[model samples]
Structures are given as C-alpha cells and as structure tokens.
Target: MLSKSISSLAKRVSSGLTPLRSNPEFWLAGTIPWLKTEQLGEKFIYSTTEKISKIALKKTSIKICRPNTLTIAMYGEGKTRGNVSIIKSEMATNQACCNIELDPELADFEYVYYFLKTQYNELRSLSSGVRKNLNSEDIKNFVIRLPQELKDQRKVAAVLSALDAKIDCNNRINAELEAMAKALYDYWFVQFEFPDANGKPYKSSGGKMVYNDMLGREIPQGWVVGALSDWIAKDKTGDWGKDMAEGNYTLSVDCIRGTDINGLNGKGAVAAPTRFILEKNKGKILAPFDLVIEISGGSPTQSTGRLALMTSESIKRFSRPVICSNFCKAISLKNSPYAFNFAYLWKSAYENKVLFGWEGKTSGIKNLLFEAFTTKYVVCMPSQHLAQGFFDFVCPIEDMKQKRLKENDELALLRDWLLPLLMNGQVTVA
Candidate 1:
C-alpha cells in the first residue's frame, strides 16, 4: 500500500471554493443555488433554495464548482464540521464548504468520498482555529492509503456505492408508499369523501352531514366530536436515568426525537442506537401502533407536540423493548384501528395549530401542554365501521413502508460492516 497527501494526488483541492466572505453583500438571492453546511452529508443534494443567481455570481469572485466534486463542511457546530458529500451536478458553495474536484485519471471521486467519510473524526481533529475550523491546508495535507492501481480504487468504491444505491432505492420506495397513504387519507377524511353506502364517494355523493359545534364544520351524521383522550388507553412521559444503565444491550431513545416526527408520521427511523440497560421497564416499552409524542425541545419555527407512530417493524428490529426519552410521551391507543385514522387527524390538528396551541416555552425548551390541548382540541370521529375500513385500507400501506425501511436498515448495516474491510484491503474486487 502506498500513501499520498490528498493535495499531491488530486488535480484540484479547494477550501474556499467561492468568495463567500468577501462578497456576502452580492449573495442576496439569484437563479443559481448554493449549498450550506446542513446539506453536505447526503450522497446527492438536488436543491439549495438559498442561492445567488447567475447575475449575482458574476458580481463576485464566486464560481460554479463543476459536477462530481466532493464537498466537505470545514466549519460548523455539532457534527456539522467534517461531514462530506458529493455534488453530482455543478453548484456553488459557501465558505464553510470546501469543494475538491479530483483528477479522474489519478483517483476515483466515489472512492475519495468513502475515504473521507471514514475520516470524519480525523478530519475534525485536524481542524484548527478558535471554532476548530478545517482550512484549505488541513484538507490538502490529509493523507490517504490505497493500492497503486486506479482500478482498485474504483473497485472499492463500486462495492460501497452498490450498497448505497440499494439503500437509496429502498428509501425512495418507502417515500412513495407514504405519499400514497397520505393521499388516501386526504381523499377520505379531510375531504369527508370516504365511501358511503353502495361504495360511492360520501361527500360528493350527497351523504348526510350535520354541523358539529365543536369542530365548527359539517361532519357525517352519527359521527361524534370528541377529544383525543377518548381513543387513548394509557399515556405517560418517558423516564431515563442519569446515564444509560448497563446490563444487556437495548434500543436507543434517540430514535424518537422531535425531528423524527413529521406531523403524525415518522420517517428515517429503523434500528435504535446501541445502549446497554439493566432491564426493560414494562411501562416504558413501546408496542406497535403506539404513539410517541415530542413533548419538549422546540425552535422558533418548530414547536413541540409532534407525533410519531410506532410500527411493528420497529418493534421487531430491537431484541429488547423500544423506549423513548424524558423528552417524549408515549400513548397507547384504545384499539389498533385508531392508529391509522387518528394519525391523520392528529396531522390535521398539527397543521391547523390545534396541537401546538397550548404549548409553553421556557428556557428555550418548549413543553406540550398535553392535557390542555387534548381536552380543548376536537377530533372528527368516524363511525366504528368507517374507522375500521380506513384502518384496513391504510394498514397495508404502512406495512409496505415499514418493510422498505427495514430493508434499508439491513442494507446500511451491510455497507457499514464492509466499509472498513474493503478499505483495509481485506476484501477485494477484481
């Protein structure tokens, strides 16, 4: 194996790829987009809405870095620095992002991407400055070891990329399935157009409607307006010790953060982080169809009271029971059917500000006024038969999403497991 300084091996390496500092005044807004530290870790970033137009690009020393270049975050806080990604297309970047366009004949860009990914901690350690910034020299002087043959580099990259491709494909499938489910929810509940007698669209077909004083709208006759407590069997805020206790390995509470909640649904959650615990608290253990609500942690733009449904796939992924942190509250529904219809209802509530209406902010942390919101906010309760039907229709879709998410988790595991082996020459491709 031979080692080479990244700068010596690469045809181009840049820390300040664009004039972000000197020309901040010219970067008001424009047609051409640029990336920030937040968008750097993904394999491909398609849009950076915060951008400067082509006209603005001409006014400053900024230039569009070409496609296939690797970009790294040189400065940021809390896992922002040292993260890497590839710009699959031509784009401009801010000062915090260092763009490296490699010489194809000398190195494979994908190979370099993976190599840099493995060196995130090392890169962070090399960072200097009051804020621990990774400068142009830091990136240039970095050393990488690899086989002399360029084919070998491509081979290693190909192996990793194949796994990534599979993971990406799985995520796409899950997103599509979720979208389909959401569309169905909107069509049925939001529109009040669920199938009526003789299988006709209810609202459009002139199904009887009565005004509900609480909801301030006309709902299907015989349906009731009720609070969330009607459907909730048991609910409690989670509990955790000062440190994660050690006995047997179990799931991590990180899986249920506020960011994981998108209205009533959760995304990008599969396996839990590895944490050891003495025993599972039976009350805290999560079951399929349960709801985990983010009761704390909020930003000015995003409030508390986000909800995520616990799926069967998640329950099966961990050997021990799944649990949330003190920041979250877990609620078990009276029946499984409520999981489908209620999730959408809660989503509507979130959008309409019903859930966040009672939030309280203190010390920069937002607390969900759970009892206040639950008691005051009303839900459109479908009849028993319609709720059952909605659950039957949406269950399969959620199942499909869960299956795809599980597959992605497995694929990611396979890729991470193989990365070091392939990087160290233990596993080779001809």
Candidate 2:
C-alpha cells in the first residue's frame, strides 16, 4: 500500500470560472454543459442545468474538462461542501467547483471519488477564508492511501461501483414511473384525453365541451372551474418539535423538513431527524395521499414550493409517525379520492412556473402566498369518479416506486458501511 498527496497522483488540479452573466453573448444559444454546486448530489453526471457558449469559453478563464474528471464543491453550509461527482461528458464548471483530473496510471478515478465521499466533514474543515471555502490547493494537498498495485485499486472500486450501479438502475426506474404519472395526469387533465364511457379518449371522442370565462378554455360539459383552495379540505402548518426530549415533550416522531422533500420522493437520501413534540400534535400525523408542501426556504435559483406525497409505503421507511417541519405545511384534498389528482395538479402548476408568480419576499427569504396562490390558480376539476379512477391507477405505481426506493436506501447503507473499511484496507474486495 502507498499513501500520497492527491496533487502527486493527478495530472492537474484546478477550479473553474463563471462567465459574466450580464453579457448576453456569453449565454445565448449555449451548447457546452456547465456545472454548479447544485448538481453535485449525484454520483455520475451526464448533463447539467445550464450550458456555456463558445464566446464565454474564449473570453474567460473558464475551460471544459474531459470525461471522467472528478469534481467537488469548494464550499457549502450543510452537506454540500465536500460532495463529489464525476462528469461523463465534456463540461465546464463554475468557480465554486474543484475539478481533479487524475493520472489514470497512479490513481483509480472511481476509487478516489468513493474515498472522498467518506471524507466530507474532514474535507470541509480544510476550507479557509471569510467565505470559509475550499480552493484547489486544499484539494491537491489532501492525502489518500491506496493499494500500490493498480489492479488492486480497480478491484475495490469495482465493488463499490456495482452497488451504485444498482441504485442508478433504481433511479432510472423511479424516473420512468414519475414520467408515467405525469403523462397520465396531462392526458386526463391538460389534453382532456381521458377515457370516455365507450373507453375512447374523452376529448378526441367528442365529449361535450363548455367555454368557461375563468379557465379560458373549453372543458368537458360536466367539469367545473374551481380554485385550488376549493379542492383542499385542510391546510395545517407543520410542527418543529424539540431536538431532544424535555419536560412534557414526550411524543417522538420523524420530522420532515423542506429539504427532505427530494429524499422522501426518492431523488436523494433523506435524513429527517427524530424530534420530541407534545402529544397534541399527533392529530397532524401524515397520512397516505396527503401532500407535504414546502412553504419556505428556497435558493435564488430555486423556489419554495417543492411537493412530496406521503404514502403508506413511504411512512414505513421512518422509525415512527412523521410530521413535517415549520418550514412546510400539509394539505388534504376535499376527499381522499381527489388527493392524488390535486397533488398532480399542484405539480403541473409548479412546473409551469406559476409558483414563481405567487411567491413573495420577506426578510430576503422567499415565501409562497399559500392562500392567494391556491385561490387564484384555476383548474378544470374532474368528477369524483374520474378522480377516484386516477387514484386507483396511481396507487400501484407508487407502490412499485417506493419499493425500489426502500431497496436503494438499504443498498446505499451497505455501500457506505463498506466504503471506509475497503479504502482503509480494513476490508478487502477480493
């Protein structure tokens, strides 16, 4: 085994640059995929949110990296600072990322990526400055121990990669299931192409239509125009209980925060904490089909209205009954049958950027005008029978998606448990 500084094992170590955003030519019709700290949660990245143009590349210090270059964030307030991801295509990054291009002969790229995952806290501690951020020098100077033989290093990486491979497979499956749900919602609601009495697409089969001044579109004759709030039966704000049990704080439950929405939805790992609250708040226990909506805490690039549907299956993932944090609120549809439908409708509105219009700034933090947003956003309401039908169709799909998610959590736990032991030579792959 040999221990060496990361700088010695690499061909180059550097950070990237962000082109001046005010310059229109730097961004218009861009083609090169650009990366940011926001895209670091994944293990392997094939694409990014924004791309850079040729002009920006030529005019600035920004440079695109080749495939397989390891990238890590230089800073974060929470768990992001030391997070790492490997790009699978040509890409450029912002100044906040530290990109490492390792010499293939000396260091196994995947091995180093996995090693760094276990060193998040240690790596973050290396940050220095008023911003408390990491620079390229800190990363290059970091030391790692690996098997002297290249083949041995590959063996360890292969074991860990295989585990992540399974998780990736699950992610692909979950994504497809999510798309299917959205397609069903769009067909039934947006296109009005839901199945008719004769089992044909409703709108296409010439279902009766009426023009409503509010919806500004022709909906089915029986379909009514209703405000979003009309469909909701209850709007209960969440409770943020004490972090530890205290006098009179005896009830124990898992508290989901605004950040845990993605993890609960299976996009990433959710680490919602267990909290102690008064027994009175037990009435707000999250039930199946109830939607947990993020009401606060959004970045400038993101919004505060992310949504997650609680399920009987998802609830089982927690140690106890779950409640959302103060940053979020739960909404129950007028009826359990319409729960899934309304959830889908809210998602459509969010994706259409409607939430952005309804958001307001208070103390520089963006907040959703929950009542105003819900009251003004109009939707062509589905009848109870149709809503029930959609609910029934989605139940099994949610079941399958959650099944894979639970498996992923277990798989990830195993991988994380093995990672450090494998890297430190406490455990061997072969």
Candidate 3:
C-alpha cells in the first residue's frame, strides 16, 4: 500500500501542469533540464561511438524534466532497443525532440527507471515513425498503475536498486581484476622487471641498453621484439571446427570480454552458442587450450587485441573440419608450453602500443581486416617457460571473477521479473 501523501503528489503532477511545446535546445542547452542521456555515461548509451555536436543540438526540442527524472528513448532504432535510463544530469535542448518528465515525488526515480525498462518491448511496439520515435503525448497518455502511496514506490525501488547496485559493483570488480592482470603482464613482459639471474633489475645489467626514439625508453639487455606471427602456430584446421558447425560446440569469451561461460559443470565444458561457431569454408577449428582473440571492434581502435582460452569442450565440439571467422579464431602456437593466459597478456601490450588505422567504411559497417592484424608487428618470442608460469598464477583469479559474474547475472534476472509487476500494482509492496 502507498501512503496518502505520495498519492496526493501523483495527483498534483498528473492533473496540475499542462503539457507545453518546447524546443530541445532550451532543455539540452539551457541552464538545466531535468532529463538528459549524457549522465548515464558511455557504457549504457546506445552507440557510445556516436557523438552529438553542439550544432546538431540546434534542431531538437527539449522537454523540461526534473532531477532523478525518468525518460525513455522513444526512437526505435536497433541501438535504441531496450534503452531505458534515469536522468541524473541536466541538459539544454533544441526543437524537434520529444520527451516526458515524471514527477519524482509521486514516483520513485529508480522505480520509474526499472518500470520503463520492463516495458521497453511494449514501448517499442507502440512507437511509429521512419526512425521509430515516441511522442510526448504517447508518454503522457501511457497508463502506469502504481500503489496509492509513495512508500510503496520506495520499497519497490529499493529492492530493484539493490540488485542493480550489486551488478554494477560486480562489473567494476571484474574490470579492476582485468586491469590488474594486464598491468602485471606489462610489468613482467614489457618492462622486463622480473628478477634477473642475480636478482637484479634487467635494466641495470652490463648488457647494452639503447634509448629507442619511438618509445622514448631504454631497450632491455639482448632483447629483440618482433611480430605476433613469430610466436603463434600457423595451423588453422582441427576436429573442433566440425563440432561447432554441427551445433555440438561453442566458445567462451570470458578471457577477452570478461563474460563467463554459464552452466558448465566439469573440466569438460561446452561453449555458449551466442558468439562461437565454425564456418563452412574454414576447416578444423581451434582445439582445447588454444589461444583465441577478438580481431575487431574495440577501444584503441586497431589493437582491440583481446584474447581468451578455448575450453576443452569447444575443441571437441569443433573437432570436425571448418574455418573460424577472421574477427575471432585460435592463435597458432609454435610450442604447447605457453598457456593462453600468457598470450592474452602479450596481446594487451601490443594493443596498447599499436595504432588502429581507420578501418570503418562510410557505409557504417566497420570491418577489421585479418590481414591488418596479421601484418601488424609485435614481439614474437619471449621465454616460453616464463610465459607459462604467468598463466599458472593468474588462472585462479580469472576463475573466481567468472563465478561472480555468473551469480550477478542470475540476480539480474530476478530484478527484471519483479520490476514490472511492482510498477503495475500486480505485485504489492508491504
């Protein structure tokens, strides 16, 4: 049940103010508009790559919304699907944009955010336009059955917010873990800071250290770096490719993207079918313990060089002959001594330093050529034994992070289910 005071506030907002036509620049560009997308940050925004210019802002109308307000992306572009976000920042807008502002006193802001998120599909269905947009009238007329009291809204929002907070925390932790791993990899491999033959720094040795103009740093003693091709195996065929095409196999991106392979029980794990598959033209895919990488589309542009390990099950599933996509596939290794983790570390270093050339066409489809990655240079050989040792140390930490992600995913499912029900008064808060 909701408190009477909250219900009164809802009534005042619902019937008090008249909807007015306004320019977006007034909201997006003005002193402070209640609702704006920029506050959510790039991660949650659709097409984080797309930027809105100040000149473009001159065209749209901005609806005045309040702080902690709720707004929906009425546009139905592929990027706009399921795009429900809470406005934590202010903006001045121009004419041409349509947005609705909710009274925060009547509705809990977080609750409204979750409420709209749950109704995203419905909203999509109702939208109509060449670009699929929702008008302010449509939002004003949309019915949301809430408890009569504000207390109920708070209670409901609290529950969902807790779950979301946890998910956010988990994501942050995972990011930190990845950063830590990459830093350690760079320290030992690039800086060569590991203990030397006499427990001294590699840099202090009598070996020649010349300052490289490109890096503006001193080179290691007797150390020479080359391209990635020098280290990886050249072979591309295997039994694993066959199983993946037959729908009996899959791949995990956990090592690269930081997502986990769910529902795996034992040492023999199956790949999640979402991204991994064997292509007909490519024969005999990657095997177990094979190193694979995302060859395209990531930060630092050219070097979106993230790597992951192929599970044993993925290898068996694709055991049949088939070719993998150029964007993602196994790394060819000269020797089995180096584990996938070492390759992942090395790839990170290469990515950090390499300049990703402009690869996207004006057509909007960005293409990362495999040839570009193959030809791009990096150090090929380091002591294989040392690389393997690094992998052995980091594998446990990766496993733990994977488990936390899985748990957070399950909790998210629960929050999604509860949101709409509570908002619609189907589920009451005590």
Candidate that scores best on lDDT? 2
Per TM-score, the best of the predicted structures is 2
For residues 284-314, what per-residue lDDT tens digits would candidate 2 score against the true structure? Answer: 7898878999998887667789999888888
Tell me the deviation in Å of residue 290 in model 3.
3.7
Worst 10 residues of 1 by lDDT: 263-272
What stretches of model 3 exceed 4 Å from their correct place? 1-67, 75-77, 89-101, 198-201, 204-218, 234-291, 294-327, 335-366, 420-429
Model 1 agreement with the true structure over 186-208: per-residue lDDT tens digits: 88888888888889999889999
lDDT of 1 at 97: 85
Stronger candidate by TM-score (1 vs 3): 1
Ranking by TM-score: 2, 1, 3
TM-score of each: 0.87, 0.95, 0.64
How far in Å is the alpha carbon of 227 misplaced in model 3?
Answer: 1.9
Candidate 1, residue 420: Cα displacement in angstroms equals 1.7
Candidate 1: C-alpha lDDT = 0.76
lDDT against the true structure, per candidate, is 0.76, 0.88, 0.49
RMSD per model, one decimal? 3.7, 1.9, 8.3
TM-score of 1: 0.87
